[model samples]
Target: MNLEAIRAIYKFEMNRTFRTPLQSIIAPVISTSLYFVVFGAAIGSRITEIEGVSYGAFIVPGLIMMMILTQSVSNGSFGIYFPKFTGTIYELLSAPVSYFEVVLGYVGAAATKSMILGILVLLTAGFFVPLRIEHPVFMALFLVLTALTFSLVGFIIGILAKGMEQLQTVPLLVIMPLTFLGGTFYSINVLPEIWQTISLANPVLYLVSGFRWSFYGISDVDVSVSLVMIGIFLAACIGVVGWIFRTGYRLKS
Candidate 1:
């Protein structure tokens, strides 16, 4: 409802990205390129194809998902955390802005950044491997949903963090491990039956599977299930954020 307030916050957060183009934009792009070089060249040579798609092409969705998850969390967490760290959160709190507007500002900026990075990596991937997108609409849908979901996750982490070390804890320790194990570079079907079942427990699997399905029409999990899983996760994040705002958890402290 408070469009002007949301826009101001959104612009402020987005402006930070422009200010640190090297860190905000270039670094993630370069890092993803390295993954393509290493995995696509060294590992891809030995493993030829997975599910009839070239090894290099197979990992594109997973790699992009990995980057989007990490960046979404990193950007979202840092965006709000900096305001908390600098003691400016109180000023924002005092403003006439609604909680929804504040969230839209910070999470919107983070998702926008992650989406841009996702598109850039997708384009960059073209140079490494021949690519085909069977369902462009589905691919874009997955991309936007993944970015928004993780951005919200990052927003929660930002509000809950007590310090810089705590800020980096979940993404490094939890998210990264889940992503690597989430059928990123290889299909889970190749795993032992037991491990394949265990892989299902990891939420990132659904994300990668669904996104990869958008590309090749193949997946480790059903695309419908993946959509449901993402919806649940997104809802959970929104619930947590709502609770945080209502309770004034860390924000009021």
Candidate 2:
């Protein structure tokens, strides 16, 4: 079903990433390394352990999650937004490409790029602190699902955005704050009981919690709950995308 169209779109997007490795890849990797240096090395020196794992190691999953979520969404949003910004989208709309195939190409590329960054960050973590995966399979599962989910979220952002400034609004204003407060640097259990209850309301907590559980086998929320939350979010995003296509929301115009 228009497999070649999908490949062309996928290849073009991927090539764009390669062409701007500095902005697309190296910058995030370096920023994350600084996070390790400041948070993991500087702060971790004072706090030795959290839930039996070294503070440095404990933050690894959270950092990875942060990088992937931001990157996935950024890439997904930019991938689509650029086409719209440059008016290339009208060309694609007139092409014999189905909406599903277009989504697959863009979202798939975004997720793939996010995974690449995530894996690199994971490898980079090995040098700062000892790393272990209690459940490698689940770790991979969480990594893949999170990348795909957030990439789709970014895709939606791209579709909704009417200008360049609008593209950064959600990720910087909403997502970045959610991630920092979502147990990226500390476990929610250590917070006051009241705060812990409030933390449960933040969706990013489940993502960080379950991913951490895959690494250390301890979590603030039930692992199954995290999985279910991700599933729900992913399904919701897919539903929104389908509706967008059906109604030609922000696309036809």
Candidate 3:
């Protein structure tokens, strides 16, 4: 399985993170903390609870999901993109490593970083609001699955990107808006009936709903539907990655 090859790549990517702790770790943590401060203070004053959960507590899952999605994409995309940018990818390609091993290394490392950040944000939330997990196991499952799925998506974006601008395009233009509008700070049920239906089409809603369900046993969407959506996305990403490797799409160029 080329375990050593996978480990080497994983360690290299991870070391890059450690080398830029301010940009890679501290910056996101600070940004999320600001969300808690602004939203928790401003909105909490007006809306005390949503579905019997405090305004501050209600947003935790969504915020964590938001961070996980963005960071997973960022980490995964940059990890592979840097090598491509510097023309080092050819060396890795020439190594005695299989495509699966290469993907496992990059995506696995990205997911690990996202998970760590998610946990840190979760813990950081405790200081801002009272928190509880009705189903800890399911919460962890959602966390891991969301991280892994988006990490794979990021890997695809990395391979497809032609420049730094293209690499940042999806996460900024697409993901961020979907997340903010996807019931992050407020419940979709509060929206107009039409908007609520529209919100259902945004995939981030399912992730936030399912994660919130795991925490408070309340959700805007069915937990099963959320799980199914995540599985579908995961499978789609794996398919794309497999096709990329087989065709040597950008890698061989």
- Stretches > 4 Å off in candidate 2: none
Worst 10 residues of 1 by lDDT: 42-51
Q: How close is candidate 1 to the true structure, as a TM-score?
A: 0.98
Cα error, residue 56 of model 3, in Å, equals: 0.5
Model 3, poorest ten-residue lDDT window? 40-49
Tell me each candidate's TM-score: 0.98, 0.98, 0.98
- Please report how far candidate 1 places residue 4 from its true position, in Å: 0.8
* Residue 182 of model 3, lDDT score: 94
lDDT of 3 at 184: 92
Error of 2 at 148 (Å): 0.7
Steric clashes per prediction: 0, 0, 0
Error of 1 at 188 (Å): 0.2
Q: Model 1, which residues run further than 4 Å from truth?
A: none
Candidate 2 lDDT over 1-253, as tens digits, reads: 9999999999999999999999989999989978887888898999968889988899999999999999999999999999999988887999999999999999999999999999999998999899999999999999999999999999999999999899999899988999999999999988999999999999999999999999999999999999999999999999999999999999895
Residue-level lDDT of model 1, residues 63-180, one tens digit each, is: 9999999999999999999989999888899999999999999999999999999999999999999889998999999999999999999999999999999999999999999999
